[model samples]
Target: MTNITFKNNPITLLGEQVTVGSVAPDFSVLANDLSVRTLADYEGKKKLISVVPSIDTGVCDQQTRKFNEEASKIENAVVLTISNDLPFAQSRWCAASGLDNVVTLSDHKDLSFGMNYGVVIEEMRLLARSVFVLNENNEVVYVEYVNEGTDHPNYDKAIEALKSI
Candidate 1:
């Protein structure tokens, strides 16, 4: 139940909030190809999971693109951008934006990633803007549930954490 807001209006989020040093939770989300992907899919690699409300929005676009650009510089890691958008829409957006680094995943089918990661916005059925970095052992090294849903995440901090892992 992290406190956050959308456009300055307070909103409720569902599910248990994760914390640093905890075992990272596993979730099922749809890849751009409509295939199911889970945390295990990226085992043995440091991961930076970037959660956004929707991929079509302006801030979301910037967030995803930022991580996508940083992905190549990150060694032994993967950049994942999770959103509530449909797989079709996610694919479309990725293709249109020509983004190849970050892997876009969708939680629209069952909100698996949204609820498991505690980023689900109860009022809007969309994920709040958040960033998580996990070590190779799947332990959370950094977690940021952005205080404001529409704002950019602390990219420098997240990247630093990822690099430290």
Candidate 2:
């Protein structure tokens, strides 16, 4: 488990921390079309996952937008922006923002992605801010569990880790 804070109040996170070199956990998240999407869908390509508490917030918006922009420059890699927000909201946000390069997935269905990745905030029922980089083989290459829910993860560091893959 990992610890995090929301507006400075400490909160407990549920699930195991994803360590680099370990096999990435497989979990289901809802795609914009309400289809179940899993880690296996991105097999054979590097994955950069951006976990956010809520897409409606300012910080989360910026984080997702940044990754969407960066996704175009990254070859053979996909950027996934995940949240506990409903699939409807996620779709609306992505359509409004024109974030085609990055994919937005929702864990609202069962919190599978959150529970499996150790980013779920038990009290808030939202995913904590974090970033994970996985290699083509589905091995975790980098992980940054942001200390604060409202704060952004180390984007540069996560991107740099992707370069090594």
Top-TM-score structure, candidate number: 1
lDDT of 1 by residue, 84-150 (tens): 9998999999889987656999999999988888888999999999999999999999999999988
- Give each model's whole-structure lDDT: 0.91, 0.88
Tell me the TM-score of model 1. 0.97
TM-score for each prediction?
A: 0.97, 0.96
TM-score of 2: 0.96
Query: Which residue runs does candidate 1 get wrong by more than 4 Å?
Result: none
Q: Which digits, one per residue and each the tens of the lDDT, describe model 2 over residues 23-110?
A: 9999999998999999999989988999999898999999988876776577899988999999999988988887665699999989
